[model samples]
Structure formats: C-alpha cells, structure tokens
Target: MPISGFPEWLPPQRMIEQFVLDKIRSTFELYGFAPLETRAVEPVETLLSKGETSKEIYLLRRLQEESATSDDQLGLHFDLTVPFARFVVENNGKLQFPFRRYQIQKVWRGERPQEGRYREFLQADIDVVNRDTLPFHFDTEMPLVIGDVFRSLPIPQAIIQVNNRKVCEGFYRGLGLPDTAQVLRTVDKLDKIGPDKVAAALVETAGATDAQAAACLKLAEISASDGSFVDRVRALGVTDPLLDEGLSELLQVVETAAEHAPGLVVAELKIARGLDYYTGTVYETQLRGYERFGSVCSGGRYETLASVGNTRFPGVGISIGVSRLLGILFGQNALTVSRSVPTCVVVAVPSEDKRSGCDRIATALRRRGIPTEVAPTAAKFGKQIQFADRRGIPYVWFPGSPDTVKDIRSGEQVEASAADWTPPAADLQPVVSAG
Candidate 1:
C-alpha cells in the first residue's frame, strides 16, 4: 500500500528535483554562505517552544520499547529553524560570530496534506546569526538571495511578501488588545480562511472588540510593491513605539529590495508568520499565477530565538519549500527534463559473441565523460536500438572498425571517435525546461 503524504518520485522526477536543489545550493554558496545540517530529531520541549507548531510535530518512539516514560522524549523536527536554533546553541563555543550557513534537508510535519502542503518535505534554508546584535542589513539580504534562487530556476517568478511581527504586535496594542499573540495567530489564517471569518475569530478567540477586529482586518488587507505601504499603515490611525520601529524596519527592507532586486518584493501587512519567535521582518512567497497555493518560501527575523543563559543570538533567514514547489510544478506540468535517465549512449552488440567488444566501447566512452551503457543481451540490432529508445538514451553506438554512433531521434549514424566525440551540449545531461 502506498503512503498518502510521503512522496516518492520516479527517476525523471527525481532528476528534475536534484537539478533544482543544485541551483539553490550554488546560489547560496555564491553569496559566501557556508553549508550546515543538524540532526533529524530534537527534544520535544525544544520543538514545542515555538507554540504555534507544537501540534504539527511528530514525536519519536521506538516500536520495541514498551515504556513511554523517559527523562527526555525526542521528536522528528517539523522545520529546520528549530533544529538550527538548537545547533547554534549547542555549537556556540566553536562557531564564529555572525555565522552564515545554508541547510538543505528533509523536515517532517504531521499536518494534513493539500495541493502544496505535505507531511514529509524538503526545505532549503539560509540564515545569518550574530552573537548579540544582528545588523539590519541581513534582513534585506534574505529576499535578495531568495530572488536569485527563484530566477535561476526554471519555474515561475516568485514574489516575496514582507511584513514584521513588531508591526502587527504594535498595531494590536494600539487597538487596545492585550494579547497580541492570539490576534497575530488569527490574522495568519487570513489566507486560509477569508477576512470575514478571521475578523470573527479575532473578536471571539483573540478577545478583540468588533471595532478592534475590523481595524485588524483593515491592516491585514494593506499590501504594496514599494514603500507606499508605510503611508497606508500610517493612515490606519494606529500608533505605538514598537509599531514605529517595525514600520521603519519594513520600509528599509522594501526600499533596499527595490534598489537591489526590483519587482521581487512587496510590503504585505497580512504576512504574520504564525511562529511566535519572529520579532522583526517576516516573509511569505507567492508564485506569479499560483497565488492560492500558499508560500513556496518563507521565514523571518528572530532576535533572541536562540539563546543560552544571558547570551542571545539574533538571526534572519528564509526557507525554500522544495517539495511543495515541485509538487505544484509537477501537477501543472510546468517543468520537464529532456531525458529520463542519465545515460546518453548505449553500445550495441551485433551478436552474443561480440558482447565483450560492446563492453569495451562503453568503457572507452565513459572515460571521455560520456554516460554509456552496453546492451544486456546480444539481441537483434533493431531490438538493441529499441532498448535505448525506451530508456531515452539518445545515441546508439555500433562497435566496428570505424566505430560510428547513431542519433536515435534523427536516425543519423556518423563516424566518431570515442575520445573526442561529444553530444550537443543540451543532450549531454537532462536539461530542465519550463513549459
């Protein structure tokens, strides 16, 4: 029986996925970000610290163990950020300050699956953490990096929506709401459930009056591609010191993005990244035409999210929802690779007696950086060609004095040397093409 949410791809699909990952990794490294990975399991308490995600965490237990009691219980990490926090705290002694690292790994979430949501998924994350104070420039840098990743890919354009927790919290306080956390949580669901329902929840669950709920919804509805959102927010008639700080930070982020990567960012007040730790700017990404599918990449600024004793580490980061992106792209047939397998050439044997000769030809081709495989059996020449055709192998080499290879698609056989012959650059490896 097939598991529902755990996706396993076939060869071609997996190849396309690897291709996307390579682009993301190279972009991160190009910007001087080092790579780091943490263990899969974290203490349950550590995972639960970020209250919003506790319900989605998958707990760990051994099947053979009878007793559930233990001093410490571990659970599969639902997201990379928590494990990253634990990693930074545990390795604080040896690491340098203002550490920048990129991690690409699988994270398990026990949430219900939908179009772009999955239980088991891969996330590509990049973060910059400082020992005490993190420079505000890192917040602007996060969207720039993500913009490069999306542009380098063969997918639709990704527009990053930016907001700040301080902005939301400060606004809530201005509305005379004592519990900003609950209001933020309810506002985060504005996209999942419409504004009317969110407004009701704000009044009922977050203890907001009808006027307060209406004000909150109005703030959430404001979004713009430039600094215009700052004025729009000011027009809302809410005032607080924290709100001013958040507005300034958000304006800087949007303006910096406009100068560095135009049309790649926007100030969206509704992007209240449900996680409680986000203190400054928050992010949510939406594809050009697939706005309803939700964020394919998102993260935020967490000041003091990772701390030990009196030492606090402030960081800014973002994550690419790898599996979710691929799922949407694959479902819509938006992308595809040129070939299924990596094999570019298949050597054919005339008869059973010549199998050894075909093997030799394949080996020589492989030495020249060509992907070649020999026919398993000395079947008919046509049958051998069919085998290559079935596997999307482009070329079929026939061993002989001259040693020529045929382009199966064109059926054009030409004399070539194994040492120097090369396929058209596009044919060498599977090229991911956007439809």
Candidate 2:
C-alpha cells in the first residue's frame, strides 16, 4: 500500500540519491553559493502570489479545528522560489547584499501522480539575490554551474533551454496582444498541448489573431545552440525595445555557455516558464533521450518577487529536481552502489563471551575512519562469513589470536592490526556509479 506520488528508495538507491546530492551541493559551493533553508509551510496567499499554481498547492488545516474563518491559513510550498522570496524579504535587514545561497529540501505539491510528477519531492536550488538590482551575468552563471553538475555526474548529458519573459511579453505587445501573461501561460503549453492547441488557446484566451498566433508559434520554434537564435528571432519581423533587451541578454547567456559548456545550453524561444514572477531570463533542462519526462531542472530571474514595502531584492536561480532525476535513473536501472549497506567490514564474534572483544575491535576500526560492524551472533566461522557476504560486506574480521581479516569475495585471509590496518580506498565507502 505505497502512496503513488510519495516514493521511498531502498538502501542502495538511497545511497545513490545521496551521492547525487553531494555532487550537486559541492558544485554549488564551488561557485561560492552559501547554503540556506526556509520553512516548508508559508501563508497560502504568499504561495499563490507568484503564479497560477493554486490548484497544485496543498493547503494545511487542523482536523480538530471546526472554524473555517481562521485568518492565518498556511499551505505546503509547491516550489522553493516562493518561500525563498519570502525569506529574503523577511531577513532583509540581517543579510548582506548580493546574497548567494543554495537550498536543498523537500517540497509538497498536490498535482495528480504520474511519471516524473510527484506530490512530494526533493529540490536543490542555487540563487543569487541583490538589493534593488541584479546583474545580467548572474543569469549566464546559473546554467554554467548546472552544466558542471551534470558533467560531474554519471548520468546522461543535460541541455538547458533558456528564454526570457521579456522577449515573449515584448513580442506579444508588439503584436497588439495586451494580456502578455495570458499569452505566456498559453505559449508555455506549447510542448504539452502542441502548437495548434496553443495557437487556438492564444486566439481564444489571449486574444491573438490567426496571424499573430502563427508568428508567435514561429518565434517559439526558433532554437539554436549558439547566437544564431538572435537572427532567427529578428527574421520574424517583430521588434520592440524590451524584446531587443531580452535578445541581447539571452545572446550573452548563450554565447557564454557556448564558450564554457559547449552544446550544454541552447536558446529555446518557447520556454515561457509560465510563472508571472519570472520577469527576465528563464531556464528548462532536458536529459538526453529523456525529453518526454519534461524538465529535470528549471528556474528564472525575478525583479519584484522579493519586496518589502520600498525595499526590493532581485534574484536569479535554478533548481534541480533531485527526486525526479533519481526516480528516472532508478526506473531505468541505470544506477548502482558498491554495497547496499555502508558497512565495509564486519567483526566476527567467536562466542557469546567473546562478543565484547569483537565490539572493541569494531570500535577501534571505526575510530580509524572505517565503517565497521560487529557480527550479530557468536556462530561458526563459516556462518559468520555468510552473514557478512549476505550484506555485501567486503571484509570479515576475526578477533582471535593474531586477529586476521578475510576478504569474503576473494577468500583471502591476512593478519592485520585493528589500529594500523586500513581497507583499500575503493572499499572504504560504498561507491555509486552507472550500471
């Protein structure tokens, strides 16, 4: 009776997840991003302030509380960005300017369960915020850091597709469409609903003419690995100052990515990010051969998401869908760990009286930075060895005369000291890799 959207991993799979998280965390830290965490729950209105994700937000209510008129209603956060915005505003006076932080936490959503869509999942986010203004270079830096993380992992390559909200909005306004938000929300559905439905939605919902819809679709279709996307958009015969600004900013991002992580990023004009808070560059990532699964990582820039009266914090960020990524890799059976458990060596108990001695030896090994465990029972040597083998423990230590350790797999025994002897580096910890 497992829940459909909330997934649990086995020991080995959990190890794999931890390994991926470590890689992502180390990469974020390498780029000088500090770590941060916000509360899981926020006022329901704060959650709904960023986007039209009201249907996806899980509201909180006490079962014993009968009154529905409570003013302090809260909901589980659907994404890291909104809570992060609230955090920046609340902590404005205590923090320094140009705050760079990385947050890895579980977020709950109420979306219907399906492949790659989880009601509860882990997200790793890195954002850089500054008072009043944020530099455009921060947008370029986001994808580079993400590219490095993917490169360091054993998973398939990820291509980050980028688009600026300004480009879409400006283009729509240039086309006589007034409601840019509705147009963006419709264009964001281009991948899921196809171009025709998106076109119809643009006309029916966003008040776009057939020609404007076709032009919008054409703009959406423009994608390039390099700066060629600029000319493509220009060729559409649409021009606006804000669109020009977005084009210049987006080109810089693409060109920078081309210089550092070539072919790892592309300019995809249709990446409308849907969220009303995203006022500038937006990003979506796709793993090679797993495009149908949707974005495994995404985020964008916001100029007004974090505001407290006259003060404002503008920021740019990207979030990695940690659970979604691991789920897909685990489903494909593409990841594996050296052992199901972290125990590298198991000390055999010669007898019930000698169990205390085995524990002492285990403690000595553990002090030497080795993951050691004492055998559960004082059984025959063969039976004790089997116990170690069953759990994939590489070594079985015998705490007897001379104190020898046996490599269970190789059946090789050697006299060793608990204080001085060390396992090979590779065997010291569970190694995670692609199968």
lDDT of each: 0.91, 0.91
- Model 2: per-residue Cα lDDT at residue 45: 81
Put down candidate 2 lDDT per residue, 1-435, tens digits, no spaces.
899999988888998899999999999999999999899899888887778477888878899977555357888998898888889888999988899999999999888887777999999999999999888899999999999999999988899999998888889988889899898988889889899999999989987899999999999999999999888888888889999999999999999999998998999999988678899999999999889899999999999989988888999999999999988878888788888899999999888998888889999999999999998888898999999888889999988779999999999999999989999999999998887
Badly placed stretches (over 4 Å) of model 1 are 52-54
Rate residue 183 of model 2 by lDDT: 89
Q: Please state the error at residue 152 of candidate 2 in Å.
A: 1.9
Provide TM-scores for the models: 0.97, 0.97
